[model samples]
Target: MPALCWNQRRRDFYAITTDVSTEGIRFRSSSRLSPGEDLTCSIRHIGLLEARIDRAVGEEFTVSVRGGRSALTDLARQFVALSRAQDLRPEVVRVHHRIVPKQKIVQVTLDGGLGVSGHVLNISASGVALLVEQSLEIGATIQVGRKLARVMRHFTHGVGAAFLEPFEPSAVHEAMTL
Candidate 1:
């Protein structure tokens, strides 16, 4: 499954889980990480977890999960359930999972510098769903907080905009402004 990890510097990188167990998780990441490094990872179907790198061999690394055994067992169970669900109905899974933002109200700026206030319904690495009064045309370029995006679709309450460039999965969290 897709995974996101944040290094000690708070920079985020994308990763894919190759193996998981109550003891640790092994993943392949494009970003080079050193052994003994610390990371905070968010895995699909599993929430945030703290880990320490045990070994790094090129793109593959193993990290010992840092938490109680019971918690790890629970997370392993959830992973099993998610794997079964995916095998049963892969089409039902979303390409990019949406997460609710802690700070929903955001300032949106149009091409001409027109500013509008909007509320974030949900956000993902690729795009955001928002509730705004302004009727924006499809393909309209706009800035949501610090990121530039283009309107992709319209809904009853608002519009869906895809980011010009995808954000690091860990960057779209509660502490972020948008």
Candidate 2:
């Protein structure tokens, strides 16, 4: 499985998992990892997994699972699900609005004026997918630029938010450009 690795204080980097077991996982990363370093590992569709470096040999490293055996079990399950999903044809679903790809850096303000930075993955008249470092609880309301939105789903990169009201294309374009 493809994985992401990043130190607590640094940005995430792409990695590939060589093996995984109930105890831990072995992966290769371009980023140098020191033993005992704290890092977060994220695999597509598996969500985030907390781990600590246990050993490093060249670019290959072994990380001890911090989420315990249950985390590994969940990871295994996700791997199986992903493999099964590959055999199915992609499904087409209609939505209230057309989604367009738009990558833009924007500031999000949560309740209490707490602010976080996120990258807009895509935007539609009624919703958006944002890539952020912070994890927000589902159903939390946040202000994306001047628009109010509610968190709908959590992804490996960040959260999906549905806006309180539909946005005009010009308004979305104008806001995202900032």
Candidate 3:
């Protein structure tokens, strides 16, 4: 399951759980974390879980679960639900979503004050992909034009952002026009 893990000393960054159980969870992180460190992980829809780093081997680490059994049970249920949902989800639905290409220059500013100029590669009601030079950390909220967006994924040229709220399709096109 997709997750975000960050120790109190750092900002939230992206991670994916390799495995999870009542006693512990194993996951891979983009950032290096030290053993014995306590961290909070916000799993999608599963809320936050307190954890202590058990060990680190390169990017993969195990964290001892600090939350109660109820939380662990809920987390396990969420994982199973998400897995089933994925199995039931259609794989080709994105083909019908229109992608409008435009080259308007825009400013992308992260919540932590990192800013970069980027070219809008395409715009849709769901999100916009930008061709940017600076590397952006996934899961960070960024300002795109007037709308707040979350960095969802990265590509060779840049990053993609999903808007905080869905916009009217035409409204997105109008806003992206320069």
Candidate 4:
């Protein structure tokens, strides 16, 4: 196992579990990030700091920072550490379903013709994530229950998708309630 250094002070852990890659990640007073703004982040692992902006989705952005190690490295280290720690002690929590949700599982072939299987990690009125058996190209097109999903980006265990046809919000909500 490798060692990772992170801060114990900052509470911004959203970047940790998320698979979204940003050219830059910044902490600002506002609740949003603009496309062109430089992002500065304080990472909790490996005492690394990074400065970057979105150069391109699913690609490396321009990185320049004065202090700490590589932001990407620090983040990667934290991920490894967190994953190992979670494995040691297991915890599970369940929330009762108010409505029985409807879901469909499917396997998709990459645009390059590589076949992979991913479970529907989640689905809502908006979209779903196919927790694929293998990684696919970032811009790959996927077939989901006759619908198409253009790969926006890859998450830790799967890829994210913006549904070509959004599901009905009420139906999703009702399904969750069941």
The residue-by-residue lDDT of candidate 2 on 1-178, one tens digit each, is 8887787587889889888876588999887777888888887778788888889889989888776888778877878888798897677453655444454778999888989898888887788889889878999999987789999989997999989986775565533543
Each prediction's Cα lDDT score?
0.88, 0.81, 0.80, 0.50
Name the regions of candidate 4 deviating beyond 4 angstroms. Answer: 1-104, 112-115, 173-178
* Model 3's TM-score against the true structure: 0.45
Give candidate 3 regions above 4 Å deviation.
88-178
Candidate 1 per-residue C-alpha lDDT over 1-178 given as tens digits, one digit per residue, 9 for 90 to 100: 8889997686899999998776578999898889899999998768889989988999999888887677668778888898887777445345677888889999999999999999999999989999999989999999998889999889997999999998988776766676
Return the TM-score for each candidate structure. Answer: 0.47, 0.45, 0.45, 0.37
As for candidate 3, its clashing pairs are none
Q: How close is candidate 4 to the true structure, as a TM-score?
A: 0.37
Off by over 4 Å in 2: 88-178
RMSD after CA superposition, every candidate = 18.1, 17.7, 18.2, 16.0
> Which of 1 and 4 is the better model by TM-score?
1
lDDT (10s digit) by residue, model 3, range 26-111: 89987888889998898876778898888889999888878667767777888888788777755535522556555478888878
Tens digit of per-residue lDDT, candidate 4, span 68-129: 34655555556677768767764523222222235445657566665555577666555566
